[model samples]
Target: MTVRPLNSVFIGGRQIGANCLRVLVDMDAPPQLVIPDPDDVGVDSWFESLVKVAKELSLPTLRGARVKDESAIKKIRALKPDIIFCIGSMQLIPKEVLAIPPLGVVNIHPALLPKYRGRYSTAHAIFNGEKETGATLHFMDERIDSGPIIMQEAFPIGNEDTARVVYDKFTEVGTALFKRFVESLKRGEEIASTPQDESKATYYPKGLPSGGKMDPSWDEVTKKRFVLAMTFPPFPMPDID
Candidate 1:
């Protein structure tokens, strides 16, 4: 359904991209709210950064539990928002929670849909030596990252770039793309969501921590791949062998 000047609630963490920020910035549009609580993980810079962004954008945000919390839901529903934007939210939203906002919810995935549809898309992308990767704005479904896609745009992965660089790069691109979508929504425009081609879609499970260590006796190409593959900071690489 086409919506106009929606009251949007931002369900996101520290790693939220620019697109989510834009939605927060629209002139008195949907009052933006943030849920910064982290679940099963230590403090993350992404959450801290999100708070800063909200302040800078002058967007209204409320912080509460990371996952399904009745209190948070009650507050959000009280606002009677039109739509919800989930950005790098660490927890899976419950179906009941998803139903609260009538206009539906949209999530920003770091990887292109149908492929890299789960956690660690960046690592998988680099491990596979993908030359290009982009962001996917899709409907949030019962399955993880398996929703119908609303919009997607690819950015070239530099040969010298590591997963961390790629992650940071996509934030800029993804956020911009997200802003465009918010504008369209405000104008009551409907975006077409292309169902993913399941045949070609691939999902990668969480990689073993030890598996990321650089292999000894590896050739130059393999060594470089090792570096790129384990570029994300949390997944560290072994010292150059």
Candidate 2:
């Protein structure tokens, strides 16, 4: 069946990247940027970059507390559109925020969940030596990256792949999958969602910059594993301390 397009909210930092831009164009939706104020933790260029992407797409941008801003909530309510397309929205969207656009508050996550859940999924996957890794499109909940899964696709991890490369690949795959999900929703089709196994769900905190840096003082095997786990470009491993 042919799927209809939608009007969506693009919430994320790193909107300038190719993966995200392509998804924005394909959705063919009017977007709004939702970013945290500068005072918020984890607020940075990524958020600003996303707003820029929205502007390029001729979408509105909103910067305020995700939960406390009455104006922002009202603005979203007024839009009353089909779906919310959220990418790197670093903050945990509150339950109040989720209720605003319940049906359409969807997110593109960077890792296969029930496994790696956090801001650093790509790095975690590489460190774990998982044979396959991919992305997921799911409903946003009060919890972080822990909603019912709408869709996921996995790709083999190459021996030479780095955290940066994995991130790039996942973002590309995720955006495409999300576009399809939006289309399905617009057509009144039920997008499939799978409940993740809680026991299998593993959470990893943001690691040191050199996540897999080997200590010159460590054993050979430990060093090798570190080398393999942290070999990705653009993301340097911290020096062994």
Candidate 3:
């Protein structure tokens, strides 16, 4: 079996990021260089701790998380990876770095593109009473979650489901797409990607809607989904008036 001659690099932290790295290694693609979540390195982050163990167990990794920082950008540019897979990156990757890779950057988002685009995607889905939400794997560009679609899979949302449940389901589907996407490239299969329609696009900002506010007049179903989506114990409830 002939594998594609592609040198991939990973820029992400935590679940989706870690999962992508695992796929890269399992496929025997190459000895990848991982730039862990910047906040994880010096903090008490389990994500960082797991990365450290991977390195100690001999997983080739480099430390980087901020794409906007000059020094970190410089280090990444020097590596010249063919493709950069980003997941769970807090900082938006600048165009300067995006142009450095041969295949460019691709990110996995929890919501289907051109519909729910932004940080609180899953929550927005629940709050707005969306019946169906899915995952999207797309090529990254200058805009936020406004990238061409590489692969997408949709899953139904239970009327009584919470945000984490939506997240867990999407993560399962998205990770599978990630695996198939990489393998398709290795096998030289054509990836049919399509441009997103901006007219149908809707953008939601990070954090709470109406700037940390919620409507008390909403029905029980709406309120239930909102609370479930936004509030998890050990984490404080969202500030509402």
Candidate 4:
């Protein structure tokens, strides 16, 4: 059967977002509109530019726009996208925009949902001494990362893995999930999703307060994990008290 192309919109930023967007484009499933995080949100040296890649692909790009804003909602509504993909965007997509897409807004999260449900997943997972961490793809709801899960796969976390290492693993698994998702859509298959278990859900707020400072009373092992978890290259490790 010939598959019908999906009318899609993409809201993303960062290296992972750039990579996932390329997957869509390379598969001939590029979105109708690309909404990248504004310069202020994604301009850091650590991240690749989603906007630049969108432009290079000749995709219609929108920047400096928040999905919660009415103006932005109007633009998205006008497109009447069949599906909206939100990958690597830190903002929680509002319900108004979520209601716009018939197939629902899909999100690719760096950590397994219902466990690490926020921005600092890898760091928190590493600091908590988790033996494994993984990525998830889900249909977004009004709440943050508390959506119906489409897919999840876990990878073991090595004893010496830092936040950056776990994050690179997340990127690998997350982008692979994106590839599978797009391929399914290309084949015109109806994706199945399971609602997340609310009881298992946990959230981590953005940023590490006190600069991820280790508590002086923490055990040496705990302190060591904290240091590793907070370590991401191009940024120095948190100062030990």
Best by TM-score: 4
**lDDT of candidate 4 over 78-122, digit per residue (tens):** 999999999998777988999999999999888888898877888
Which model, 2 or 4, shows the larger lDDT? Answer: 4
Candidate 3 residues 1-241, lDDT tens each?
7678768767776566666666777787743566666666634342434365446547666664467778867877787887888876666889988898878798988898889999878878887888898999999999999989998999988877777778778878888999999998888766678999999998887865434466789777766777767753345777655
In model 2, what are the clashing residue pairs, if there are any?
Answer: 13-46, 162-232, 210-237, 210-238
Q: In terms of TM-score, which candidate is stronger, 1 or 3? A: 3
lDDT of the candidates, in the order given: 0.72, 0.64, 0.76, 0.87
> Can you write out model 1's per-residue Cα lDDT over 1-241, one digit (the tens) per residue?
5456667777776465334665556634645465544441334343345655666676676654754777787887787777888886667888877887776788888898888977778767876778989988888877888888898999998888887888887787778778877778777876678777888788776662236676677778777866786777765556765
- Cα displacement (angstroms), candidate 4, residue 152, comes to 0.5
Regions more than 4 Å wrong, model 2 = 1-5, 15-18, 21-24, 32-48, 63-68, 208-221, 228-236
Per-candidate TM equals: 0.84, 0.80, 0.89, 0.94
By TM-score, the candidates rank as 4, 3, 1, 2
Model 2 vs. true fold: TM: 0.80
Tell me the lDDT of model 2 at 113.
Answer: 80
What are the clash counts of all predictions, listed in order? Answer: 5, 4, 0, 0
Please give the lDDT score at residue 176 for candidate 2.
73
Write the number of the candidate with greater lDDT, choosing between 2 and 3.
Answer: 3
